[model samples]
Target: MQWVLDHLGDISSLGLQHIWLSGVPLVLGLLISIPVGWLATRTRWLRGILITGSGLLYTIPSLALFVLMPLVLGTSILSPLNVVVAMTIYTIALLVRSVVDGLTSVPEEVARSATAMGYTPARRFFGVDLPLAVPVIAAGLRVAAVSSVSMISIASLIGVSQLGDLLVDGFNRDIAGELFAGVLASILLAIAFDVLIRLAEHTLTPWRRVQQGGGT
Candidate 1:
C-alpha cells in the first residue's frame, strides 16, 4: 500500500493514460458506429459485408493484430494513436451490430405512425428511432467500454504507462501486490462505468416505467 501511495504521482499519471487509451476509442467507436449501423440497416448487401468483415477483423488475436499493425501501416503502433485505432476497430464492430439490433428492436408501429404523421425519413430516425434505441445502444456501450479497458491493459506492452505497467513490473519481481492492485483497480473501473451506463439506460427509457404501470 505504501508503495502505491509513495509512487502516487507516477501511479496517477499511468492510470490517466490508461483511461485515455480506453476512452478515446470508446467515444470514437460510438460515433463511427452510429452511422455505419444506420447505413447497414438501409442496405442489405452492405449489411452482410460490413458485419461479416468487421466480425472477421474482431476475431484476430489482439496482440498479434497490434504487433502487426505497424508492419501493415508502415509505422509502429507503439503510440497512443496506434492503440486508439487498434482498440477502436474491434469495438466498432461490436457496436455497429448493437446499433443495428437496437434500431430493429423499435416497434414497427412507431415507424408506421411516424410515417403516417408526415415525419420525414430523417426526422423519424433522429427523433424516433434513435431515441427509442438509446437503452439497448447504451447497453452496447457498456460492453464496449469494459472490453476496451481490458484491451488497454495490453497497450502497456507497446509503451503506454498504465495500470498494466503495474502488472508487468509486479510479474518481474513476483510482487503479487502490484499485480493484484492493478487488476483490482481495473475491475473497479469497469464496474463504475457499468453502473453509470445502467443509470443512463433507466433515465432514457421512461417508456419502461409506463409499461411496468400498464401504460399508465
Candidate 2:
C-alpha cells in the first residue's frame, strides 16, 4: 500500500496509457469490423474466407506479432503503433465473427417481412437487423474490451509504457508491492470496463430489459 501510494503518479500515468492503448484499438476495430461483417453477410460466398483470415490473425502469438509489426509497418521497434495495430487486429478478429453471427441471427421471416414492408436493404439493416443484433454484438464488445485490457499489459514487454511496466520494475527490484499494485490495478480496470460495457449494452438494448421484465 505504501509502495503503491508512493508510486501513485507512475501508476496513474501508465494506467492511462494502458487504457488508451487498449481503447483506441477497440474503437478502430469496431468501426472496421461492422462493414466487413456486413459485407460478409451480403456476399455469402466470402463469409467463410473473411472469418478464416481474421481467425488466422489471432493465432499469431501476441508478443511475436508485436515484434513482427514494426518490420511490416516500417515503424520503429519501440513505436506505440506496433501495439495499437496489433491490438486492433486482435479486436477485429474477435468481433468480426460476432458481427456476422449477430446479423445472420435475424430470422428469415422477419427479414422477408421487412422487405415486404418496403424496407430497402440498407433501411432494413439499420431499422430492423442492427437493433436485434445489438445484444450479441455488445456481448462481443465486452469480451473484446476486457481482452484488450489484458493484452495491453503484454505490450509493456516490448517497450510500450503500460501497467505491465510496474510488474517488470517490481520484479527487477524485488518489490512485491509494486508487482501487486500492477496486477490489482489491472484486474480492477478489467472489471470496471466490463461493467461499463454491460451498462452500455443494457442502455442500448432496452428491449432486452423489457423481455426480462415480462419473463419475470
Candidate 3:
C-alpha cells in the first residue's frame, strides 16, 4: 500500500494512458461495427461472413497481428496506429455479434406494433429496437472494454506505453516492485471499467430493474 501510495503519480498517469488507448478504439469500433452488424442482419450470407471473419480476426495472436501490421501500412501501423487498430478489431469483433443479436432478439410482435403505429424505419430502430437492445449490448461492451484493458498490456510488446512494460522490465531484471505495481494496477483498472459499464447498463436499462415485491 505504501509503495503504491508513493508511486501514485506513475500509477495514475499510466492508468489514464491505458484507459485512453483502450477507450478510443472501443468507441470507434462500436460506431463502425454496430452499423456493420445491423447490415449483416439484412443478408444471411453476409451475417455468416461477418461472424466468421471477425472470429478469425479474433483468433490471431496479438503479437503476430502487430508484427504483420507493420508490413501492411509500413511504419505508421507499427506506431500507435497499430495498437489502436489491433484493439479496435478486438472490440468490434466482440461487440458486433452482440449488437446484431440484440437487435434480432427483439420480439416480432413488438416490431409489428411499431410498424402499425406508422413508425418510420429509423424511428422504429432508434426508439423501439435500440432501447430494447440496450441491456444485452451493454453486456458486450462491458466485456470488450474490460478485455481491451487486459489486452493493452500486450500493446507494450508492440511498442506502446502500457502496464506490460513494467512486467517485461520486471521479468528481465527481477524487479519485484515493478511487477507488483503493474499487476495491481491492471487488476484495479479492469475492476473500474467493469463497475462503470455495469452502472451505465443499469442507468440505461431501467426496464431490467425489478421491484422488490414485483410491483411496476
Candidate 4:
C-alpha cells in the first residue's frame, strides 16, 4: 500500500499508456478488417488467402515480430509505432476471421428478403447485415481487447513504457511489491476493458435483450 501510494503517479502514467497502446490498434484493426472481411465474402477465392495469411501473421512470435517491425517499417527499434503496427497486425488477424464468421452467420432468409424489397447491396449491408453482425464482432473485440492489454507488457521488453515497466523495474530492484503491483495492474486493466466491451455489446444489441425478455 505504501509502495503503491509512493508510485501512484508512475502507475497512472503507465496505465494510460497501456490503454492508448491497446485501444488504438483495436480500433484501426476493426476498421481495416471489416472491409477486407466483406470483400473476402464477395470474392470467395480471396477468403482462404486472407484467412490463411492473417493466421500466419498471428503465429509469428510476439518478440520476434517486435524486433522485425523496425526493419520492415523503418521505425526506430524503441518506437511505440513498432508495438502499434505489430499489435494492429495481430488484431486484424484475429478479427478478420471474426468479421467473416459474423457476416456469414447472418440468415440467408434475411438477406434474400432484403434483396426482394429492392435493397441495394450497399444498403442491405449497412442496414441489415452489419447490425446483425455486431454481436459476433463484439465478441471478437472483447477477446482482442483482453489479449492486447496483456501483450502490451511484452512491449516493455523493448523499452516501450507501460504498466509492463513495473515488472521490469521491480525485477531489477528486486522489490516484491512492485512485481505484485505490475501483475495486479495488468489483470485490473484487462478486466476493466472486458467490462467496457460487454457494455458496448449490450448497447449495440438491444434486440438480444428483447429476445431474452420475450423468451422469459
Q: Against the unseen true structure, what C-alpha lDDT does each candidate score?
A: 0.83, 0.91, 0.82, 0.92
Model 1 lDDT per residue over 140-215, tens place: 9999889888877887787767788988888989987777778877887788778877888888888888898995
* Highest-scoring model, TM-score: 4
Q: Would you list the rank order by lDDT, best first?
A: 4, 2, 1, 3
lDDT of 2 by residue, 139-182 (tens): 89889998898888888788889999988889999999999999
* Candidate 3 error regions (>4 Å): 76-78, 210-216
Per-candidate alpha-carbon RMSD to the true structure: 2.1, 1.3, 2.1, 1.1
Instruction: Report residue 33 deviation for candidate 4 (angstroms).
Output: 0.9
Model 4, which residues run further than 4 Å from truth? none
Between candidates 1 and 4, the one scoring higher on lDDT is: 4
| TM-score of every candidate | 0.90, 0.95, 0.90, 0.96
Query: How many residue pairs in model 4 have overlapping backbones?
Result: 0
Candidate 1, superposed: residue stretches over 4 Å from native: 71-77, 210-216
- Residue 4 accuracy (lDDT) in model 4: 86
